[model samples]
Target: MTTAPGPAYRSAPTTFGAVARHGRAWLPVIGLTALASSAVSLALPSVLGHSVDAIVAGSGYGRWFTIAAVLIGVGVLCSLIDAFAGTACVAGTTAWLRHGLVSQVVRGGAEGSREFDSGDLVSRVSGNASDAAQAGPAAVTTVAATAPPIGSLVLLALIDPWLAVAFFGGVILVVGVLFVFARRTAEISLSYQQTQGRISALLTEAVTGLRTIASAGTTTREERRILGFLPELHRHGLETWKVLARSGAQAAIVGPLVLVAVLAVGGLQLVDGRITPGELFAASQYAVLGAGLGSLTGVIGEIARARAGIQRAAEVFAIDKVAHGLLPLPPGPGRLTFDGVTVVADDAVLLENIHLELPGGATIAVVGPSGAGKSVLASLAARLRDPSIGQVLLDGVPLPALNHHALRTAVGCAFERPTLVGTTVGDAISHDAIGPVRTLAAARATHAHDFVRRLPDGYFTPLPKAPMSGGERQRLGLARAWPASRLLVLDDATSSLDTATELQISKTLTEDRYRRTRLIVTHRTATAARADLVVWLDGGRVRGVGSHQDLWQDASYREVFG
Candidate 1:
C-alpha cells in the first residue's frame, strides 16, 4: 500500500528503543490503563478480606462487598482500555514502519535495492514490519504486566514481614525462568524469520519464472527447490515449541510455591495470634498475585519476536539510498558524457574506467560480446545507476546533480524484459504521464498501436486479459519510454520484435523525429549499421569508438555480432 511519508517520528529507527517510541503518544494511555488494572487487582483482595472479617465478626459487611464488586468492574474496564490502546499502538506503529520501509525501497530504486531480493523485500515490508511494530506495545505491556507481582511483594510485606520473605525466594526463580526464556527465544526467533524470508524469496523467483519452469518440465523440481528449506523451518518451529513447553512446565511447578509458602508462614502467624484471619486472607491473595509472573511469558515472547523484526528492518534502513541533487537541468542539447567511469560489483569489474562523449540528438549503437558491459553503459546514459568511480553528465550537469523530476523526464529507458505495471493496456503504454498525442504517436511509432486496437476492449483492456507476446510487450515498453525529451536508452528493448518491425522501429529511432539522443544496446548488426556512431566494447572497456562501417573492418568486432 502506497502512502505519504508520515510525521518526523516515522523515519527509520536504527535501534529497538527508537522503534518503541513510534507508539509514544499511545504509551501513556497504555501505561495508565495497565496501572489502573493492577491497582484494582491489588485493592480487591483487601476489600474482600475486610468483608470476610466483618462476616466472621457478625457485623455489616455490605459496604466492603460493594467496594469489592466495584473494584472488579474497574479492573474489567481497565482491561478493555488496555486491549484497545495496545491494538491501536501496534497497528499505527506497524503502518508507520511499513511506510518508512516502502518509502526507502522506492527511494533506493532498483540499483540501491539490488542487494535485496524482491521476495525478501516483500517479506520485510509485510511480515517483518508488522512484527517490528509490536515493539512499542510489547515493551510497554511487558513492563506493565510486571506490576501485579511487584505490588504483591510490597503488600505482603505490609501485611507481615514473614510472608514477604517467604514469597521473595519464589520471585527470584520466576525471574530466572523469564531470563532464560528470553535469551533462548530471541536467537531462535531471528533465525526463524530469516529462514522464512529466504523461502519467500525463492517462491517469488519461482513465480517470476513459472513459465520457464513449466516449459522445461522442471515444475516438480522447482517446487522441491522452493521448499528445500522446510526442514530447517520445521526444526526452528519445533525448537520454539520445545522452549515454550519447558517454560510452561517451569512456571507450573514453581508459580504455586510462592502461594504455598505465604500460606504456610501466615498459618503459623495465625496460630500464634500474630495475624488476623482477614490479614491472612489478604496475604494469600498477594501470594497469588506475586506468583502470576509466569503469565508474562507471552509478553516476553512478543518482545523477542519484535526485537528480531526490528533488527531485520534496521538492516534495510542501514543501506543508504542514492542521493540526488536539487539542481535543475541547464538548457542544452542532450550531450551525454561519461568521464572515466568504472563499475565494480563483488570484487569483479563490470565496467573499467571508460571515457566517452556523445553529442546530443545522435543515434549511438553500443555493441559488445556477452559480458562487454553494453547494458551498463546504457544504464549510465539513463541514470538508472551511478558509476563506481566517475561521473555521468547530461548536457553540462552531472546526472546526480539534476533534480529527480528533471532527470527522469529528460531520460527514458526501456529494457527487453520490461515489467508492465499499470492496470490497462493504455495505462501501461502511457505510464509516464505523457499526453494523449505523444502517447498515441509513441504507440504508432513502435507498432504497439496496431495490436492494442485489436484487443477485446482496445486500450482499456486489463493487462492480464490483453495476452501480448514478447515483441508486443517490447513495443509497449518502447511506447512507454517514447515521451523522453532528451535521451532514450534502449537496453536490448527491441530484441523480441520481428526483423521487419525492428527495421521500422529503428528507422523512426534513427530519424530522430523527437530530436532526442538514442543509445541502443543491440545484438543485431543491421541495427548497429543504422546508427550514426558505433561503440565496440571488448571485456569491460571500450576497444573502439567509430562508425559501424569503420568498426566492421575489425575481425573481433565482426565476431561480436556472431
Candidate 2:
C-alpha cells in the first residue's frame, strides 16, 4: 500500500542553497551594493593615515579639507545604497518563500492534522518564512563586515610583516571559538523554535475546546497543561545565552591582547627605524580595527539563527504534494466507479477491496457503523484523497488523470462543520457560484437565505462579526456546496439541521431540475429509504448494495442504525 511521505525536511539542501535557488535574481544586486559600501569603508582608514602624514609634513590645510569632504560624500552614498539593497532583497525573498510554503501546505498528501497542528503550521509558515527571507540580506551584510578586517590586515602587512602574522594568529583563535559557539546556538535555537510551536499548539487547542473544558470543570487542569512547556522553552533560552557569553568572553580577552602585542611590535620597529611614525600610527589603528570589532562573530550568530529558521521553513515544502495527472476530464454525465479500492496505513486497513458503480444523476445513501469508512468512500469519490490500491473513475476516466480545475468544477463537498472563510455570506457562497442569481438560489435551496436576509446588512454582514448557531453554519456550508452542477458529496452535513429543514433540503436535491450525483453519508434510516440506492458497509467491506427497501429485510443491516 502507498505510505505517507517521509520527514518533512529530509533530503533538503541547506539554507544558503535555498536562498540561492529562489533569490538568484536579487542576490547579485545585494552583493554588488554591499561591495560598494565596503570599498568606501576600506578607504576611510587609508585616507586617515594619509591625512596624519600630511599634517606631520606641514601640508596645506586646503587639501586636508578636500579629503574630508570626499569621505563624507562617499559615506552618505554607501548608506543609501545599502538601505535600498537590503529592502529589495528582503521583499523579494519573503514573497517567494511564502508562496512556496502556502502551496505545499494546501496540496499536502494528507490532511494537515495528520502531520502538524494548526498553531505549529501557522508559526512555520509566517515566522519561519520571515526568518528565511533574511538569509540573503544577512549573508550580504556578513560579507561587507568581513572586508574591514581583511583590508586592515593587508595594510598592516605593508607596514611590518611580523606584526601582521602575530595578529592573524590571534584572529584565527577567536574565529575557532566563534565557530564552536555558532554550532551550539543552532542546536539550541532549533529546540527553542520547536518548543514555542508546541506551546502555541497547546494554547490553540485549549481555546478551541474551551467550552468542553469549562463544562467538564477542568479549567485549572487545562491551564496547567498549557503552561507546562514554558520551563523547557526557558531552559533552551538559557543554554543559548550561556554559549554566547562564553564566546564573547573569549573574543573580549583575545581582542585586547592582540592589540597590545601589535602596539609593542610597532614601537620596537619605530625605534629601529624600520617603520616611520605615521606608519606605526596606521599599524596600531589597523590592529584594533582588524581584531577589536569582532564583527565576524556577531554576523555568524545571526546567520546561525537564520539557518535554524530556514530549516523549519524547508520542512513545510518538503511534504509531498498530492500527485495528479495533467489530462483534462471529458464532458460526460456524473458516473463514478471504484475498482479494487483499498486504503491501509500502519498495518491497519481502513478500506479493503471495495468495488462499486454509481449511475449518472442518481442519489446514493451510504450507511455504515462508526468505523465502516463511509466518509472515506465519499472522500475518494471526489478525489479529496487518491486511493492507495485502486482507481476511482469519473465517466470512465480515472479521477487522478483529470486536471485540478476540471476536478474541482465537477465535484463539491460539504462537511458537518465547515470552515467559513469570507467576510460576508454572499462572498462565501459566491466563491462557488456560477453567477449572482445562482448564488442566491443556492442559499435559498439550503434555507440559509432567510437568516442571511435578517443579518445586520443582509448578505453583506462581516462573517467574523456575525453570530451564527451550528445549524445556521451548516446551512451556509450547504449553500456553498449547492452550486456544483455534476456531483455533490454531503458527509453528515445536515446532522445539525431540524427534521423539517433537512427534509425540505433533501426534496430540493432530488428534484429533476436540481438533481446531480449525490452521495450522502447518513445514519438516518428514513433518509436512506428515500435514496435510489443504498450501499451498506461493515468493517471496511461492502456488505450489500441495493435499494434501501431490499436491504431493510436483513436484521444485521437494521442493527447499523443502533
Candidate 3:
C-alpha cells in the first residue's frame, strides 16, 4: 500500500532548551566574569564622586588620586576578562549549533523530502542558522551583564529614594517604548528572511534553466522576474531601521530628562543642609548608571529580531511526521508480481487493479497509449513509488517487506528520460560507480562505446558544451543500466535510438546471453513483437494479455493497434 511522505526534520526540544542544556557548563565562568566587570564599573563612578568631594573640601589630592587610578586599573582588568569570556562563549555556541543543525538535516533526510525546497533549505541552513548561532550567546551574556547594574540601582535607592524613584521610572518608560518598537522590528525581520529565501530559489531556478531561457530568447524576462522581489526586501530593511532610529531618539530624550529631574531634587536637598555634596555627587552618579542601563533597550531590540529568526529556523527541526520503515528481502533471482495494484498521482488513478506475475528469467513487454500508465506501473514494481492499493511482490516477499537497498540493486530500471550525474562519457556510462573494465563492456553492449571511443579522450571525453542530442544521452543511459544482476527494466529506453541500433540492443536483451527477468515498457510494435508475452493496458487498466499475434487478431486490440 502507498504511504504518505515524511517530514523534513524531527521534533526536537526548543532552541532555547537545547542552548541552555549545552551552555550550562560555561555558566559559572560567564557569571563570574560579568560580576567582576560590573563591580569594577560601578566602583569607578563612586570613586570619581569621592575625588570631586575631596577637591571641594580642599583635602590633599595625593590619596584620592591614587584611589581613582587603582579603580581605573581594576575596571580595565575586568573589561579584558569580560571580552575574553564573551568571545569564547559566542564561538563555542556557534560551532555547536551549526553542527547540530547539520546533523539534524542529515538524519531527517531533509534533502530527499518532496516538501523540502533545495534553495529554501539552503538559506535556512546557512544564513538563518548562522545568524541565530551568533546572536544566542551574546544575547544571553548581555542579560547576565545587566544584572549587576540592576543591583546597584537598588543600593542607590537606599541612599536617596527621590533620585532613585525618578531614575527607575524613566528606565521603565524607555524599556516599554523600546519593546513595542522591537516587536515591530522582529515581524519585519522575519518577512525579510522569507523574501531572501524566495530570491535565492528564483536565482537557482534561473541558473538551472539557463539553456531553456536562451533557446526561448527569454533571458531578459527571467532576469526581470528575479529582480522583482528585491524592492520588497529593501522596503522591509528600511522599516526595521526606521523603528530603530525612532527608538534611539526616544531613549536619547529620556536620558537627559531623568538626569535633570535627579539633579534638581538632589541639588535642593544639598542646599537645605540635609545632605553633603559627596552624597549629591553619588546620587548623580546613580542617575547616570540608570541612564546607561536604559540604553541597553536598543540591544534588546536586536535580540528580539534574532529570536524571531531562531524561531523560524527551529521549524526545520520541528517536523516529526516523516515515514521511515525498513523492509526485508529473501535471497533469489528477482521476480515481480502485482496483485490488484492501483497507482494514483495528482488526484487521478493512473493504474487500476493490475494483476500480473512474471516468473524468473522471463521477458515481458508492456504497451499502451501515451497516457495509459505503463511507465507508472513499472515505477511501482521498481519501488520508486508504492502502489496505492494491493500488493507488489518481489520474489516471495512483499515490496515493503524487502530490504530497500537490496531490492533496488536486484531490480534496476533505465527511465524514459534518464539523468546523468557526471560530465564525462565514461562517468555517465557506469553511473560513475563501476570500474573501467565493466564501464567499457557495458558501453559496447549498448553500442555507445564506438562514438565514445572516437571522442578526444575516448571514454573520458566530457559531455558537449551545449545540450547533447537526445539519442546520444539515451544510449549512455542504457549503458549505465546494462550492468544489473537479476531484473532489468527498460522504460522506453531505446526511444531515442535509430532503428538499426534499437534492433541490435533488443536482440542482445532478448537473446539467451543474459539470464535476467526483463520488463520492457514501450509503444513500438516491432519491439513488442520480439517479446515472449505482451500486456496491453488502456485507461489505467490491463485489457488483454497474450502473445503479439494473438492480440493482433483480437478486435479491441486491432482498434488499439490502428
Index of the highest-lDDT prediction: 1
Work out how many backbone clashes candidate 1 has: 0
Q: For model 3, what is the C-alpha lDDT against the true structure? A: 0.73
The runs of at least 3 residues in candidate 3 whose Cα sits more than 4 Å from the true structure, single-residue gaps closed, are 1-16, 19-40, 51-112, 272-286, 293-328, 340-346, 364-367, 416-419, 422-484, 489-494, 497-508, 511-514, 523-527, 531-539, 544-562
Expressed as tens digits, the lDDT of each residue in 414-448 for candidate 3 is 87678876777777877537798999888888888
Cα lDDT computed for each candidate against the true fold: 0.87, 0.79, 0.73
Model 2 misses residue 48 by how many Å? Answer: 2.0
lDDT of 2 by residue, 165-262 (tens): 87788778766887798789778878888898898888889988998999999999998998999999999999988988888898888888888888
Clashing pairs in 1: none
Residue-by-residue lDDT tens digits, candidate 1, 7-96? 112234558899898798799999898889889988988888898899999897999988988898988998899899989999998998
My TM-score estimates for the predictions, one after another, are: 0.96, 0.93, 0.79
Instruction: Indicate which candidate wins on TM-score.
Output: 1
For model 1, what is the alpha-carbon lDDT of residue 428?
Answer: 93
How far is 53's C-alpha from truth in model 3 (Å)? Answer: 4.3
Candidate 2 accuracy as lDDT: 0.79
Runs of candidate 1 exceeding 4 Å displacement? 1-13
Indicate the residue-level lDDT of 559 in model 3.
65
